[model samples]
Structure formats: structure tokens, C-alpha cells
Target: MLTTKLGVLLSGRGVVAGDRVRDALADAGLTMRSAFTLTQLAAGPVNQQTLIDLLGVDPSAVVTVLNELEGRGLVSRQRDPADRRRHIVVMTADGTRTLHTVEEVLDKTDDDLFAALTPRERDQLERLLTKVADADSCAEKY
Candidate 1:
């Protein structure tokens, strides 16, 4: 019963946070889907295969997402200099701006979500979450 309650609470919080982020992105004149895709590309230069691996999606789906991003001029793809046949994905200036906005929204969401905790409690919570995230079992889930 406790586990079920925790699951429901977590899912509800996730949905609310997602809605906030989507609204924030829309206010910044960007789509939430595009913002997410662009931010992923901004993390580093990645090939389609890398994106597929990171996103846990099929190659064709990733290609479709990349194509949409490219069409919006939010992301650019270039042939890898070392491997001309392979393409590398990079964020454009617009994408960088959108990513910055999204990050701000995420920061605010974090602050709001943890507002009930004292500063020390927040720090402890963060440490515990990070530890769980770095656990072997957690890595396997990813």
C-alpha cells in the first residue's frame, strides 16, 4: 500500500512538472517536444545512433525527431569530419536559447517541488537521490 501510494504520488508530481515545463516552453515560443529534443542535442554532439541509445527509441523514430528539429532550424546535422558518411547532431543558436529557457523552468520546478523541505533536508534529499541514481540497480534500469 505504501509503495502504491508512492508510485501514484510520483506520477502525479511528474505530470504536474511536465505541464509546467510545457507551459514555460510555449511561453518562450517553442514547443515542449522540440525543446526537449534540442536540449538533448545540446548536451553534446551526438550521432543518430547515440541519440537512439540515449532516448531508448528506435532509429527511425529518432530520425523523424531529428528531421523535425532540423526543419525548424533548431538543430543542425553535419557529416562527421573523421567519418564523412556519419552525421553528427548539434544545436543551433535558437536551440541554445530554448535550452536555457527550459533549464530555468526546470530549476524553478525543482525549487517549488522541494519548498516544503528545510534547507538541510533538501540537501539530504538531494544526496540520497544522487546516491540512488548512481546505484548499480538504477543504472541497469536506465
Candidate 2:
């Protein structure tokens, strides 16, 4: 009880959240990070450097992820024609279809995770968390 209150109050990392989320995503053969990477590419080709910055992951880690996605035919990395130096990551057609499928599964999984909370309470928590995240953005602006 106290821990749940404190989690909402402090907006700290939910230590077990990742494991649960991973389990939730496993049905789609996706990891949390892999799913996130797909969403990022859904916007369009992401430059390697931009991906590193946006995802806040190490360059080597990004490379490994890109390699894995490429092997799965979920994404492809091609050199930027305009900038020759950076590689742009783009999602494949299969990746798009898979992304939607995973999204549906993840939605259900998210509901399952939050099943302990009433729907109204879930909305309230989401609002509070959004406020906290917005505050974080405001803090970063300075």
C-alpha cells in the first residue's frame, strides 16, 4: 500500500514493470525495447545518430538492435544519401503489420497489468503520471 502510493508520488522506476512488460510482449516475439524501436521507425527512417540520441542507448547497443531487427526483416538500415555518414533505419512492410499486431496485444497486456486498479483509478494515475512527465520536460527546458 505504502509502496504503491510512493511509486505514484515519486514517479520512480517501477522495478518489476520491465519484467512484466517483457512477459506481456513475449507472445509477439518482441522485447520492450524492440517494440519501442519499431514505434520510432513508424514515423519514418531514423538516422543512426538520431536513434542513439532519441532512444538514449549506447551506439553499440543501437547497432546490435538494428542488426537484430534487420535479421528479423523488421527493419533495414541503409546509408543516408544526403549525408553518407549516417544510416537511416526504416521499417519493412512485415514490420508494419507486425507492429499493429503487437500493438493490439500490448494494449490487452497493459490492461491486464493494470487490472488491479479500477478503470477510474487507472485514468487518475495516468493523468498524474502525465503531469509528472510534463514537469520533467519543463525542468529540462531550463
Candidate 3:
């Protein structure tokens, strides 16, 4: 189906975009793992388990990435005041700086990738993608 092909193509584009952003971040002395973890933290302080769930990564993988980030002094983990059993992950000032750099990289990647599309086409694509994402989220509630 054409729609299916489009979907696959979009996924491939996403992978390419991610790779480009990763490389840019790496050149800036930031790892893809740390950038991703900090992006999660940017939403707010969250537990390791929640980050694992959101990223769809294994617990061990999440732990390893978090540990590396901690070692880099980009992230800090602390016991949740409300629940000592849970660890809250927060980004440090260094992490925030890295996130800003990552954001710039992602912006450039998006601009380059979508440059082929006209402004109207880009607007339509964004609207359609937003609708699909919203639908998926709504479906999850059922």
C-alpha cells in the first residue's frame, strides 16, 4: 500500500535524522545515550523505571546509560523525598547545556531533511503527523 510505504519511509527518515543529530552531538563531546537521557529529564524529574518505560529500553540498559551520565557529571540521581524507595533523575547545568546543543543539532537536521517539502506541504505533513500521534495516545487510554 502507498500509505504503508509512506509510513516506512517516514520511519527511515526518522532514523536518519537521529543518526545525524547523534553525530553532531558526538562532535560536541556528547554521547547519544546521554543526550537522550537528558531529553527525558527535560520533561521533569522522573524515576529510572519511568524513563525505561518511556524509552522502551531494558532496565539494565537504562541503568548503564544513567550511570555513564552520572560519571560524566551531567546528571544526578537522588532518593525521592516522597518515596525513598524511588530514585529521581535530574539533569545538571552541564546536562542543560548539552541539551541546548542537542536541540540545535536536531533543528538543523530537521531543516535539512525537510527542505525538499514546500511550506504548505510541510504544514500539512505536520498536521497529519500530529493527528496520528494524538490518535495513538487516545487509543492507549482505552
Using TM-score as the measure, which candidate wins? 2
- lDDT per residue for candidate 1 within 1-142, as digits (tens), equals 7657965877787798768777776777666556656767877789867777776656786688788778878788999999998899999897787678778877787788778999899899789867866674534321
- Each prediction's TM-score against the native? 0.71, 0.79, 0.73
lDDT of 2 by residue, 49-137 (tens): 98888787777877887788899999998999999987889999989998999888877866876889998998998899778777775
Return the TM-score for candidate 2, rounded to 2 decimals: 0.79
Per lDDT, the best of the predicted structures is 3
lDDT of each: 0.75, 0.80, 0.80
Relative to the true structure, candidate 3 reaches a TM of 0.73
Residue 66, candidate 2: alpha-carbon lDDT: 79
After superposition, candidate 3 runs with Cα above 4 Å error: 1-4, 11-15, 130-142
Backbone clashes for every candidate come to 0, 0, 0
Worst 10-residue lDDT window, candidate 2: 133-142
| Pick by TM-score: 1 or 3, better one | 3
* Candidate 2 Cα errors over 4 Å, as ranges: 1-5, 8-17, 116-120, 134-142
